[model samples]
Target chain A: MDNLNIGRHISGQFNEDLENVINHVMHMGGLVEKQLSDSLKAVYENDKELAQKVLASDYKINNLEVSIDDECTRIIAKRQPAAGDLRLIMAVIKTIADLERIGDEAEKIAQVALESFDSKQQDLLMNLDNLGRAVLQLLQQTLDAFTRMDVDAAIELHKADKNIDRNYDALMRQLMTYMMEDPRSIPSVMSVIWSARAIERIGDRCQNVCEYIIYFVKGKVVRHTSPDDM
Target chain B: MDNLNIGRHISGQFNEDLENVINHVMHMGGLVEKQLSDSLKAVYENDKELAQKVLASDYKINNLEVSIDDECTRIIAKRQPAAGDLRLIMAVIKTIADLERIGDEAEKIAQVALESFDSKQQDLLMNLDNLGRAVLQLLQQTLDAFTRMDVDAAIELHKADKNIDRNYDALMRQLMTYMMEDPRSIPSVMSVIWSARAIERIGDRCQNVCEYIIYFVKGKVVRHTSPDDM
Candidate 1:
């Protein structure tokens, strides 16, 4: 399709500008999730090439984020959408940001992997891999809820965050024990700890996305509380 | 002066539109610093009234952030700024986001303080107070650096983050020891630990702001690097 035709199609098919915004967010989400998965795999396999690919792709993600953000601004300026649509558009804009940061975090993890490519921290790296997988699962679920506008799924993701937190706490303790047992493992273990913390934070970002989804759908500030509690 | 005259005067007085964006960002930096200060101080003192004040003022901070971001976007679109101006505008935008999140983190801490207002976790609360002070100091310094466009200050703030990290690790250990020592303290200590972690993460956010400042001024990436090393 030509640019003019494409613009007309988007403007005509979508009842509100929010539909276009949501579509762009979903597109960004898909790319970011792929970045997360590939980066984690690269770290696990110690594949520098894959890590490089993730890093290179970050530029594209950054560009996409800027474009989506600009579009959100335009819509907010022109349409002044309200209620559910307004919240959803705002949430999509906010979630796109969180997703972009998640991509950056993945790139940072990949960079760390590249740094310690030949290190003897295989066990710690595997722990990070596990944490990354948990984060990926959370992001996938969060995105699903966002796309479907499923408040229940969003709530579930928020509760599931505690599980990631518990796992992260365990990982920290295990690393602390390793550091305490052998001072030699302190530096290497510290890097692994940072990566695990990064992954855990990515999980938190996903939860934030889920929270936004719930807010978009329900108009409730259900932060720092469980869905069941709400 | 009339509105048009005032606009023309300022437009002619400033060297570049980037300066206006940077100045607006500094305004946001000032606001966020106040928010962080009051929010943490309210937590430290168990001042429910002050916490309420922080909560109420947060909307203003959020609004200021939106304005700053809108200003940055306008500058970017109008001037298509490149090189230093581009990086600076981008940095300001990112810093606004970080500052906004820091405000949210501080609000979260204040919420916990409000929740445990009548609780019996004095020691844990005291540790949280210490952590809050440390994190606030780092945030203040980082914001000051951005205000002054001082790369050295930003670097110094980066080095100081290690202290916050060390404090966080120590706090985690203390919280875990408390939890193990007295199961009864688990709930309260856990809450305090989470607040402390949030505060430390706020310090990390300040570090990110500092990194962005460096990127703005020097067009360099300084993540995962220390001031001394750099």
Candidate 2:
């Protein structure tokens, strides 16, 4: 990841400060990844304690975001970096926003895990587990792509988000069927639906991060650009 | 709101550029406000053409966002303005992101209007209308806060978002009851649920924009700080 090597255009304290900001971003990403993983685990195991822990840890992620944002602003004000350096700070600022929102989504998923669901709905749980694991993998790869500054990898991950969307749609359809068949299960099924929506949104956020990475490295605005064109 | 003027430290082209960006932002806000209103009307009137127009107009909003972001980056690189000036640019950048997202949410609501719902669900539609109007008003007031840089107005709008959340929760409960009473309505009810979620998110995004206005005007990181303290 360090081999990707930004801030080479500037020297001395600017380089060091840039490195610190990157490190903080990667650290925030690590925390968000864990939150997502733990959130799914809580849902799968029905562990209310773990769910509560995920909720409590959100403040740490939020604090990290605020600090990282401050660091970016300070560097910009002090260094007055231009071109690629300016873009790097901008990218980091945007990426942290997405990371913070992803953390919020993870907290929502954890909240759903704390809800009571009938054991008969275990089938729905199994499906949600599959979707959660896939989204978790996408998030992991997206972070790795960020660390590497790998545009190709980022593009690939952008395409991968579509699969998560499909999975979410399929799960929602199945959940709807369950609700239709057993009206008593509507509340629990709705929880699963909400969790699926959160997971799907995480996929979208991961794609946004990937877009930022591509922009940072290639100096191209790949956003709203069709994937096939890339 | 105008009394909360920023970028007073450095005069000339920097101020002009900052003003240009702010004007563009307020212009974008007007577009988003219109989109939200038209989307609600589409749902209420079952007007598919109006919904399609809302969806089509999103590209224009997206283009505006890209251009405003480009202008901000250009100003930072060219001017290298510090302190309050730097913070003002940062606030605009963040605020534009939120505004773009609000446009996306409006598009989602417009998409829901394209879906066919039974006449029996008219009651649910009325509840959604109430929720939609409340969110639109919040968005309008938040934009007004941005234009005026009114910290007090922004703070008041921040508190108002909670009402939208409560209204959303109530509407969801009612929708759930309807779904349970008649399984045949699940598909249409789910569309309403999704649209309502999008509207709820717009309120959140509008609050975020208001927070940025407060930060810009007061140079305070009021986010995550308790409202009681404010």
Candidate 3:
């Protein structure tokens, strides 16, 4: 091939690598979202099987993170792309961290559910499920932003995280009220609180991913920066 | 220069760059620690000036973050160092994010202090100061780990974060109790709860830095892996 065509061939391979990495990320995201969804249902219905599934999938998620991390390193070593390509690699590394944390959160949720299996705290489970749904929505939005490379959508996810925070706070207050009214509710309420906190953390991780998308696309650190301010 | 001398020259320059990055990180660490310290004292003693100082210094800390970020990026772009050097750059970038977030948390504490300017929540402030001290110690340990590149110390910081989590839970319980007893304590107690949460977040950020240190030296992700397990 001529020099120009050689350059085109390399660029084609680079884009292919990017696609593979992004595909892996989306697959991992889907698994994590399923884990969250199932873990919440497990908690609500006391379905130990679903909870165990979520816990088991954590190892898979961890493996995916390691593989993706290795892929990122290999891509840089092999392609030696600069500037924007480098930033995309950096974003992949960061996105892996966030995705792995989401897996951990899912595992934590399962563990909490398993612990609360014998309790008559279905109400607390309902609250946790609600929190999980809100967090799941945030994660979905964040993943969408990454897939589309939509900075505005990523910003929207960042803004939506504040609502999750507010919801978390309200859930905490409700749990506190339940626990104070009846000390017998303490253990169950505390478990739910832990789950809510974990889900809220998942939301935070999603927002972290959203911030990475913005940074990946625009080289801006918009983590704590509000959308209106930006 | 011969290849041997060239090797030594690169090594020396590499060490010097590492030192510069470490020093900048330490300076940022110290600034964040002081901001946390002063913000706690400001709340406890109702020192508005101290709070204002903490808030004002945040701009400098933020500027420092951008500068350090630039230096690390510049090193990576110019040197294109491989293996450990590449890992160091990655770790420094991640560390800067954690340190910047710690600064954000300090700013948050200062904002809370400023908002509660006329409030009389001395008892809550006392608890928050205790919690803040705990977080500062965590930050200190994280900094020591970074300076020494001590994986064991980093592991210890990761484990120590659990203690901060427990302390935050206790604080949350105490605040709930106060709010339950007297509904009027809701607003002030809520502020105290948030301040304590912000300080706890700093501790978490410190642990995150420690995790990056582990990745820096060992090239491993300890997200779901506990220190004992490691």
Candidate 4:
């Protein structure tokens, strides 16, 4: 919020309104980050209770998205902000949608923990733990970049998403090999594959948030210009 | 666009600006729909050339999304639309992002066509064709509802997303059986699995567009209230 630096308007209410929306967005980001981290922990430690916590807590993120969306609409209607203030509001709206989906993907990841894996398949989850932790770090850094509105940090972390994808691809190959070796293991291994996919998607969402960070700060749509270059 | 029934302001330019944005959104929606349809066709006919066309033409949708997004930002800044007009702008902004992702998913589905399928696996692609066509119909209906801003159609089509999910789940179980029965077919079957996942995601994105339609018309966030219920 401090980084926004757009609160020196003649109208005091307008300044407070903008500040509140930004603060609420940060609060929502914190909750989403927590949900993602807890879901990974649930998968890593095989804690059904923690997995249940991840499931039960998702409503919090969904509710925050709705209320914040309402606040954005109200701000635009009441304040009619222009330029940087407008961009920030736009970015907040887009970011919350991505954040909400990230929470959902985390929930998908947590579901894997509820399905019991055999001792051998436990090692597969261990590999998934590695990929999950990598995605978690990407989310953390992306959140920090978003908080500070740091374009350089956003670009740097955007590159880090490639690492997460590489890890996910490697893990997927390993799982396929395991499934082929023992067709009986396909059911359980399939869950691990799906979790890996979820973790990879979380990385993609982080990459999207990073683009929004750059867009808000630089007023440039940096989506296709990334190393993905698409 | 006509169903919006706004844009009768004292400022003549405001009316034109609002109309232009809506028209561009519909145009973009058309391009996205074609991409989804062509991708499915490429898969069904096993036409790599058509699949390649789907891939190459994706940039049109991406570029339209960015341009239309800029138009929304410009309209908001210049016209300061409130109430329904404001909701329409917000809907356009959100709908374009979902539309772009749908393009990406369609591109993913089309990628499956580039790889050759065996005679046995060709039957699986036929099943995928059925699911893909069903999802294509959902997209068409969702786009129609969005253009008209019809709340009832949006709700009805939102329910239709459940049917898409049901088809996807059934197709997935069948694919898993195919893979289990013949483990060596994992690599090719894996592509179909990913393609199926992409098709299902397009349905989810259509469902999202439907919610946006309802949000624009009713000025309510109808996400968590769906039968999927978040």
lDDT of 2 by residue, B158-182 (tens): 9899899999999999999999999
Cα lDDT tens digits, model 3, B1-230, are 01111234346877677678878888888887788778877877777888889888887777888788768766766666676667767778778878878887887787766765334457777778888888888888788788777888888778888888998899888877766666555556666766887888888788878888888778786755756777
lDDT (10s digit) by residue, model 4, range A163-190: 8888888999999999889988888888
Error of 3 at A22 (Å): 2.3
Considering the two chains of model 4, state its CAPRI-style docking category: medium
lDDT of 4 by residue, B1-230 (tens): 55688656788788888878878888988998899889989988899999999999998998898888888988888888899889989989999999999999999999999998889999999999999999989888888888788888888888988888999999999999998999999888999999999999999999889888888888888887856552
- Candidate RMSDs in Å, in order, are 9.1, 1.4, 5.4, 1.7
Q: Residue A132's C-alpha lDDT in candidate 3?
A: 87
Show the colliding residue pairs in model 1.
Answer: none
Which residue pairs in candidate 2 collide? Answer: B1-B148
Candidate 3, superposed: residue stretches over 4 Å from native: A1-16, A108-128, A162-187, B1-19, B46-49, B52-63, B107-128, B155-201, B218-223
Report the lDDT tens digits of candidate 1 across residue range A1-230: 01112243234533445556667788889999998899899889988999899988987777777677667655544554445545555566678778878988888777766766335568878888888898898888888887887887778788898899999999887876665565545555656766787798898898878877776677765554645785
| TM-score, per-candidate, Cα-based | 0.59, 0.97, 0.78, 0.97
On TM-score, the stronger of 1 and 2 is 2
Q: What fraction of the reference interface contacts is present in each model, in order?
A: 0.00, 0.76, 0.00, 0.55
TM-score of 2: 0.97
DockQ of candidate 4 against the true complex:
0.76
* Regions of model 4 farther than 4 Å from truth: A228-230, B228-230
Tens digit per residue, CA lDDT, model 3, A1-230: 01111234357888788778888989999988888888888887788888888877788888898789878877766776566667777788889878888888888788776865345467667777888888888888788788887888877778888888998999888876666576555555656766887899898888889877877778776654656886
Against the true structure, candidate 3 has what lDDT?
Answer: 0.76
